[model samples]
Target: MKIAVIDGQGGGLGKTIIEKIRRELGNTVEIFALGTNAYATASMVKAGANDGASGESAICFCCKNVKFHCIIGPIGIICPNSMLGELTPSIAEAVFNADCIKYLIPISKHGLYIPGVQHMQINDFIQEIILELKKKLTH
Candidate 1:
């Protein structure tokens, strides 16, 4: 299965999620790191993403045109109004309009205030999503 991990800014969250996915799933799944900036993409790549891409155009292009089994990220990834240059209405619409399931980590408005740090335990959420994906794929 192919999973896209989207992030913006420093990509701390994306890096955490990517590492957890790799540790738990091993090489059983393909991970694509879609970052709003080069730093974000590089972070996830270091965390073990199979591939990585950056920029708004790359994100929009991938969300609109590529085929993936799932998209995993925080709510900001789909918010379109949060991260600078990364989250746009078009990108959000494309992700929401895609024919794949999405696993959105709960993110509150206040959570956005915290810069450079991930406020939530995305690893746990990713574990749940991975379990669900495992069940679905096994079935």
Candidate 2:
């Protein structure tokens, strides 16, 4: 299975997710780190992504071309003008239109409140994602 991990800003979230995925899944899944900037991509790549790419064009092309089993990222990936506008409209559109399931981590952002999702640590969210992936990928 192929999973795309998308992030912007400092890419810390993406890096952590990639690391956890690698530790839990081993080599069972291929991970691609898709970032809005080179620094973000580099961060995930250092963590253990099989490959990575940056920028809106790369994001659009990968979302359209890659047959990813899942796309994992913050909820911002679907929101236009997010990540201090690093995530362009085209990137958001491509991610929303991608032919893959998405697992978004609800973050506490300015003026955004995801109802019913209590604020949790990033580690907790990562654990949940790992559990979900195990349930789906093992079957």
Candidate 3:
């Protein structure tokens, strides 16, 4: 299956998620890193993503043309006004309106204010999401 890991800012969270998915799913899954910036994409690529792309235009193109089975990321990926930068309203809306499935890690209100650290442990959350996806895929 093809999966896209979308993120912004420093791309730390995206890299961590890509690593976890790679270790757990092995070569059975195709990972695409879609980042708001070059740093974010590079981070995931360094973490072993099969492919990586960045910038608002790249994000928009992926959202429109890529036939990813699932898009995994934090709620910010869906919120254009959030960390997604140039891939704002239009791109976010396209993603939201698309037919592909999305797995969003819920972030609390106060948590959004914190920079650097995520609201919850991304490792645990990503593992859970992966497991759930595995179950669905297997069934």
Candidate with maximal lDDT: 2
Clashes of each: 0, 0, 0
Give the per-residue lDDT of model 2 (tens digit) for 56-111.
99999999999999999999999999999998999999999999899999988835
RMSD of 3: 3.8
lDDT of 3 by residue, 39-126 (tens): 9899999998999998878888888898988898877777776773544876688679656899877665413655544556767788
Worst 10 residues of 1 by lDDT: 109-118
Per-candidate RMSD, Å: 4.2, 1.0, 3.8
Model 2: which ten-residue window has the lowest total lDDT? 110-119
Candidates 2 and 3: which is better by TM-score? 2
C-alpha lDDT score of every prediction, in listed order: 0.82, 0.94, 0.81
Q: lDDT of model 2 at residue 95?
A: 98
User: Any residue pairs clashing in model 3, and if so which?
Assistant: none
Q: After TM-score superposition, what is the CA distance of residue 132 in candidate 1 from its true location, in Å?
A: 1.2
RMSD score of candidate 2 (Å):
1.0
Q: Rank the candidates by TM-score, best first.
A: 2, 1, 3
